[model samples]
Target: MELHHKLRRDPSWHPNACNICGQLGHQAVNCTNGTINWRQIYGDEAFTIKPPVFWSEMADKQKKKEVDVKELARRAREYARMQCQAQGIDYDEMIRGAQVFQHAPEQKPQLPVTSQQNGGSAGGAVKKEAPEGDLPEGWAVARDAQQRVYYWHKKTQKVQWDKPTKDTPVS
Candidate 1:
């Protein structure tokens, strides 16, 4: 009997399983139904849906965010390394002093000198020797290891590495 009909006939009776095949939701008549999920008919992916575009977009955004973070972290490490080198602190001694051994060095790992371009108020400038004519008047450009470009206003000594606001000039 149908679940509804059985319920009507006996109020105490409960439909715990399928009334047709006495199994789960599957029925004997529709056991081979291959419209919704074709896994019943075929064993491979037949017509899978395209993943949401935002998944790739989010991944790109995340990659950009990671590069930005690495750039900023590189700046900080350069500053620390400079200060330590000035104080004549050896790399091993500084590492022990900072107790960085407990954590992943990935956070403060030393970046290659070639990774830096511009050198001024921003860290990593020591490795960069910008030629006078290479840059426009009162303007500088720095590139990090990730190849992320940073625009420098030499006049104001201001550096912009991320998306610019409307106030920033297009040129």
Candidate 2:
């Protein structure tokens, strides 16, 4: 019997109506007709098919993101070797000292032997070297191209723009 006819015949007819299949006698939540096959009912227009993926291309992209430790170490070693060559410093010594700045010895003007023999002094214009006692152990002062003094710590491989005090080191 139709739902309206049954409802007309009996006013107390409270049969559960399923909203999914639209049938009488079970609620929509309790309906057990499984999933609705949209493709079966609506044909190929139900959903679009995606193009097949190339796994090799995806794998290559994933591999590019990962780093090889050995390759990185080799590159780092090569860079350090290049830096040592460019700076004219010993790579082994630099590696051992860790951060030590081995400054190239400054060339000083030599007084002529005749001037020394004549007992004439080189004037009072002698440039005094920066005192090492002010700096901490394994630290030294160096001048840049502008002659501005910068402190270097060999062991820590650190540089500071300000002057280091005897009691405390400048960061």
Candidate 3:
């Protein structure tokens, strides 16, 4: 039998054609035919091709209403309060914690370098600065208050603060 006949006989065989341009080989949905002939589709002779309006252009043309910042904030607080009550948590504490993170300044720490001549390790014994405040579960110490440093932990799970000391060996 022929290759096309064999393919047709296959259970998974599907016809491929560009729906927009009426072209073969490619699927219909992803047709790159930019020219949308509305007249051809609708059979309306009055219809003509017009320049496509981008999402941004359409948004720009729309009349925007001024938003009240204070009102929006009040509504957001009310919503948050309801959510917190549903989840059984302090709303004020959650807001305060969020504010602390929002207002906190960004800090980056420099790694300590060791001198080879001083008999020190090649990559200096880097001492990790202690965390400033007791953050909530899953939250990490972004900035240390004592040495004024920042650290990032990719894990979203909560870590035990009072675990093994720095002297403890890792298995």
What's model 3's TM-score?
Answer: 0.29
Question: Can you write out model 3's per-residue Cα lDDT over 132-171, one digit (the tens) per residue?
Answer: 4554333445433333233333353433333234443333
lDDT of 1 by residue, 13-44 (tens): 34554333344565333444323444546645
Judge candidate 1 against the unseen true structure and give its global Cα lDDT, from 0 to 1.
0.56
Tens digit of per-residue lDDT, candidate 2, span 45-142: 55577677899988999999999999999999999999989999899877767645455467766543432332232432222355657576778887
Best by TM-score: 3
lDDT (0 to 1) per candidate:
0.56, 0.62, 0.54
Q: What C-alpha RMSD separates each model from the true structure?
A: 20.5, 20.4, 16.5
What TM-score fits each model? 0.20, 0.24, 0.29
lDDT of 2 at 3: 77
Q: Identify the superior model by TM-score, candidate 1 or candidate 2.
A: 2
Worst 10 residues of 2 by lDDT: 118-127
Ordered from best to worst TM-score, the candidate numbers read: 3, 2, 1
